[model samples]
Target: MTFELLEKLENKINQAVETIALLQMEIEELKEDKANLAGKTEQLQSDNDRLNAEHQQWQERLSALVGKIEQAEENA
Candidate 1:
């Protein structure tokens, strides 16, 4: 092969190697981001469940208080 043709082939090979390296790095970053998102989703679900339980408890308490108040007014 001519010197000029060999030089062109080497440059093309170098470019291909650089592109592959960049793609590999991007894949690793995406995997890390996916894991972080999953953890956040699980934590949010747990918080929502706790809030729902607390709300149910408060409702029961309020109902009992209302019944007591009504009885006192009737007796008075």
Candidate 2:
């Protein structure tokens, strides 16, 4: 091949290597973002579970209080 052709091929190879490196860095950043989002999702799920349990407990207490009131009315 001519010298000019060889030089062009070398330039193309270098550009490809640089592009691959940049893409790899972007992939790593994306992975880190995904990990952070997953952690936040887990924390939100835990909070939801806790709130639901408290709501259920309050509902049970309210139901018990209502039953007592109804029983007292019947007795009176």
Candidate 3:
């Protein structure tokens, strides 16, 4: 309609375009961060599994040792 109104509209359009660009960049960064976090989570899960296996093995060994100690004390 008027020149002033057209100028204001153009400024608003430019700002919207800039805001959209910033939002898109932020979204990309978040996606990358999520991928990295997922990979780290998988690695931690693997480590936990290995540790659990080792713990079970150690528990069995300890139980056997305790049994032997009890038997020795009984003999004494």
Candidate 4:
């Protein structure tokens, strides 16, 4: 092969290697982002569960208070 052709081939090979490296880095970054999102999702689910429990407790308290008020009204 001619010198010019060999030089061109080498340049193409170097470009391919650099592209591969960049793609690998991008893949790692995406993996990290996915893990972060999963953790955030878990935390949100936990928060939702806690809030639901608190809401149910408050509803029960409100219902009891209303019942007591109604009983008082009936006695009066």
Give one digit per residue, the lDDT tens place, for model 3 in 1-76.
6999999999999999999999999999999999999999999999999999999999999999999999999999
For all candidates in order, the CA lDDT equals: 0.96, 0.99, 0.99, 0.99
lDDT of 1 by residue, 1-76 (tens): 6999989999999999999999999999999999999999999999999999999999999999999999999999
Runs off by more than 4 Å, candidate 3:
none
Error of 3 at 59 (Å): 1.1
Clashing pairs in 1: none
**Candidate with more favorable, higher lDDT: 1 or 2:** 2
lDDT of 1 at 51: 99
Worst 10 residues of 4 by lDDT: 1-10
Whichever of 2 and 3 has more TM-score, that candidate is 3
Model 3 pairs whose backbones collide: none
Of the two candidates 3 and 4, the one with more favorable TM-score, higher being better, is: 3
TM per candidate comes to: 0.72, 0.84, 0.90, 0.84
Question: Which residue pairs show collisions in model 2?
Answer: none
lDDT of 4 by residue, 1-76 (tens): 6999999999999999999999999999999999999999999999999999999999999999999999999999
Candidate ordering by TM-score (highest first): 3, 4, 2, 1
